[model samples]
Target: MECWVPLFEIFLNSPCPETQASLWLQQSFNQPGPTTISTSSFLSLLTKPTHITITDSSSPSHTKRVMWIQTLPNAVQARVLSFLHYDCRRFCESELCQLAETMLKEGEKLDFWVKRAAHQLLDVVSRSNYEWFSSLNLDSEEEQVENEFRSLPDWLKDDVDETDLMLPWLPISQKQFNLAMQFSSCGENDDPMIEFEEGKREIVEQVIEEVDEVIKEVDEFLNPQVEELVERLKDRLLSLQSTSKAVELAGEIRELCKGGSQSLAILGKIEPWRADDEITSVLVSNLLDGNEDELGWRSHILCSVILPKLLVLKEPASRVLLTATIEYCKIHQRAAEYALLLPLILRTEGINSPICNVLTRIVTESLHQGHVSAFCQKLLSNEDDLKKFICLPCHQSLIGSKLVWTDSLFNLMQNILNHNIHLTQDSIDRLVQHAWESADRFSKSLKFGNFLLCFVTKCAPMLKSQKSLLTEATQHTNTLVTKSVLSKLSTL
Candidate 1:
């Protein structure tokens, strides 16, 4: 009963190949052919599950040996015999024989006779009849249906006993029942009071049980005498056992202790197989393969716990964990915590992943809502992989933030302008334009007017030839920069 029988019950109850072959053999017995077995012979011989090899004397006919030669349950065997279109049902009837074979005089049947018959008949059959079920050449019509049924969880196949579940006869008197039926039958009107009373009583009973449990737990924890008695009993029990047995029993005690709600306090500790890579892979697989009912909770666990653990680890292991987080977000459509990890993941792993698009969307939305952390801002300023993925709002948030305008801003801007590598001139221009627009649109903004101009001004000698840089700078300049914003554009 404790072995998870429900999981295998459906499969066990399914039509065995032997059963199908039994049906086929019964049909063959009724056919007009030399290969068919006579009813008298089949009944007498089939009584023992010894294999029977039937061969066609006709030219080029293949012989089949039905080898299931063991006793099938009476019901199943009877059903198999009924497959014959003829009067095969007569074989299933008992008390038909005038002389019943009684074994009262003997201790048991002769083992010699049984063994001789079994070796010859079964050895001749060579294999089970069930193996030839495919020889009947069935269609693929039931293939998909069988596969889906096979994949179903065992609990779905288990039939709960409704005998225990059925409500007892109503406790009300016959007069009360008649009155209730009369009211219930009149225009078939529903009585809300009747339904409400039943539901209200169940809820009140449940609440009282929960309250009693809470009070008991409180009393147990607060009572010092109970704790002392438990400690004394534990010491006495250990004292009674030998040292080796005591140590052995200690493992069971530890395991029992690790199974309650209180055990979750150690989720951060090792021994949950934290050191094993195989364990992580298995945990991830189980999460992904969990039934639809568990998926929401699994996703919550992934985001709240798994993600923090992954972030602390080194990748490509972390990369695999990151993929799990994004794939979960991409499929489950609930990415609140995962979206928060996008920036840290982007900074650490970069954009070489299948879930980059999911990550991009997460980052854009997070940045737009100003949900990104300060560390993410520094990462965004440095990492170019996610730079192109950033939306206009994200770019605006980055530029207008106080973090971006620190002393490093001058060198960062200078390197960005001089590099002229991954980002195009037009893209850089648009970024500056959007930054100015975001600052102006928001009530409070950074004074990028001079800071940004300083970068261009610091590189004025180098940009004197590239007037496009001066023109772009001039376009982004505002009142915060009093000096000719772009010194190279002084004449222009």
Candidate 2:
């Protein structure tokens, strides 16, 4: 252990890197060496990594240790590089990319050491940074800022689909048309005279026109299949009770359209059933009616089927669906904010409608327990209706129902109290009240007490044996819990 201390001291005290590295390398191979070099000095040796040499036949553990040391943070990487150089052949391509992406996401400053290491990697790839740079067009200062922060530019906000990048259906510009023609044409029948060449050009133009006609014909021939696919998409949309799928389907159709697909032609083929009404029905059914089966169907209809259908309408009652949704929730006493609206911001119809006013009134009036339970049962049964007629109300209703479930509230509180030390006063109060109420209600009926205890002692443990906080909390608060349990019991 004492063999290398004098050698390490001499290496550290040495001014020249070559001398220090020579001594360090000689001692690294020697067994029983205890060097008292500081972390900074050790790091300096690592950063100049060329000094250390291990054979390819070294044990896996030694290789891994060397690699791990090299991949450490800025100070560590620098020290390791001094000894090992910035070579990273041991890491997988995907793993390196992931690490880079993570570092970029974390807003870590690109220190000199990190940049040098990254540059060495760039050299290994031997590809021009410009080509990779072109793929991410963050040339502008604003774009550069957004990119550095791992965010997309405003221009890319709507470019949500991977397929959109591959599609070639966008209307062709005059320049693109010329370019396409230029690339398509190749001939050896050359005219010597300039005037004769004009004739050849005319002939080529005619041939290009013919090719364009053929392309158009091919597109026309494929229209039927595209139309069939669009119809299938429409059918799927209309059958869904949730609008979530509508946004996704919209993206899919957008890609199809961009791909020069003839799916848009099927919009004309839809039967004259009112789209707004159909969409309204879907929203109501999912949000109020609790029809999970029709959820996927409704999503397709709202954004994909309904919006496009509305665009085609001679007199589009676009607001009808939104109004109907709000009004239905009002009459049904459901909450007003729809969760689907979060994603479907572009498709939502109305900010102010009679249905919304009614929903507000219903939520305000039915905030109490007796009214809430009655309202919840009705809303749960007719979730689809609520979603169709009033999406916001459906969300509000669900949120309200979740809050109203005192047993769930108690458990949630107990969990926070036992597991989370950073509990806010409001959360603590809310949970305490919920637990107290649940305990009060349980203590009144012998059957309820047995059921509660049995569930905590048996079913829950079987399901998740590791956590017993809920059982413990309920037991600790048994007396106060029993008192509240009795009070609620008298009413039940």
Candidate 3:
């Protein structure tokens, strides 16, 4: 290191690159039996790199040195070139692209360094070069390598998968990684939605302003059509300007329609401003108007607004809506929609009401609709909704007690258990007690009561170890993690 300090200083301080490089070479290498060459000839020779002889002035005997650029080995030179700035690196590539294969081993490591250096010039490096680099069978023969290399774009192509630059949430398995790659490149909609909303708001404002301008232009004094129209049937229209009269009229109308949905819908259509409850009542009435054939013609606005409101309302009268909806569904075979809405209604109603009749109807419906599991689970979800519902006073003998028992209550209880919604051990005795009392009070047959008692006891608490959805999901996650670990271990 000490021997090179003075020589390094000469290289740094020297005005001419040729002299500095020449002196650098002299000190770096020394060999015997050297011949002299002129300064111009030596400089020309340096352009085409080759072994050369130079006299070492620092040696007292004028010892000779054979100097070349071999101080930098092939691997280290490639590494150094990799760190250069984009513009400088590009210039180096133009000059040295031919020498690249000769200097570095022909493999991915050398190819990767070249690609990496070029990548620094592009902001979206990860997006570029993925397909070309990945598709190449570098281990293949020269002909295949050449063919593959030729297939790659002259310029870098945009990446097909963005998983590489993102966090390594991609699993150990390649198939899973490919499947789970979050396809965010094209379907991004947040900005587009915001822009669309702004545009729509602007259009709406412009339309309102244009309408106001048109209204301003209409001279009320001269526009006889407006006056004549207003005069023709002013008696039929309800004027809301007179607050006291309008309110009294509304109250009277509300009283008249207080009976049911059909009346409420008529009341809503008569006056529609600031009337949410009346409007919803009209909507539900319309939705369940036994128009399964006319679903295509039904107003989406009415259906969309009323269904949720009806479901959220916990009134026993909601049963009317439920019963109507069920009849409509059965007639239309709308099992999909009925199945989804029924559960929502049941969850809202809870177990307090006399809902056993509703459950029995649904049970009958489920025979054809095929969503028995979902409906049963929902019924039992409300702190024993099914249990308490089955024991309601009004519902005890009111169900007509007339089923043929084709699908017996025992099998129904088993189905409920299969759905993983059973009661606790403590509730079993009480439920049995309630069933027997109801059976006796209603003067039902002993045989039927005995079957009911047997069904309830078996369904509650005995099968507590049955796998619920939560337990199944937990087990599934554990299995996935174990498989992933095993995959990684095998790879290692």
Top candidate (lDDT): 2
The candidate, 2 or 3, that scores higher on TM-score is 2
Worst 10 residues of 3 by lDDT: 163-172
Better of 1 and 3 by TM-score: 1
Where model 2 places Cα greater than 4 Å from the true spot, the runs are: 1-59, 63-234, 238-248, 252-390, 393-402, 414-421, 443-492
Better candidate by lDDT, 2 or 3: 2
Relative to the true structure, candidate 2 reaches a TM of 0.22
Each prediction's TM-score versus the true structure: 0.22, 0.22, 0.21
Model 1 lDDT, residue 340, Cα? 32
Model 3: residue 476 alpha-carbon error in angstroms: 34
* lDDT score for residue 388 of model 3: 22
lDDT of 2 by residue, 194-270 (tens): 43445444543543453233223223434576768767766765565556764454455445544232322333343
RMSD of 1: 29.1
Candidate 1 Cα misplacement greater than 4 A, ranges = 1-266, 269-273, 276-278, 288-296, 313-326, 335-492
Model 1 residue 68 CA deviation (Å) reads 61
- The sequence of per-residue lDDT tens digits that candidate 1 reaches over residues 297-415 is 33233433344444344334444554544444433332233223432243333222223333444433222111233223323443342222111111122222122223223233333
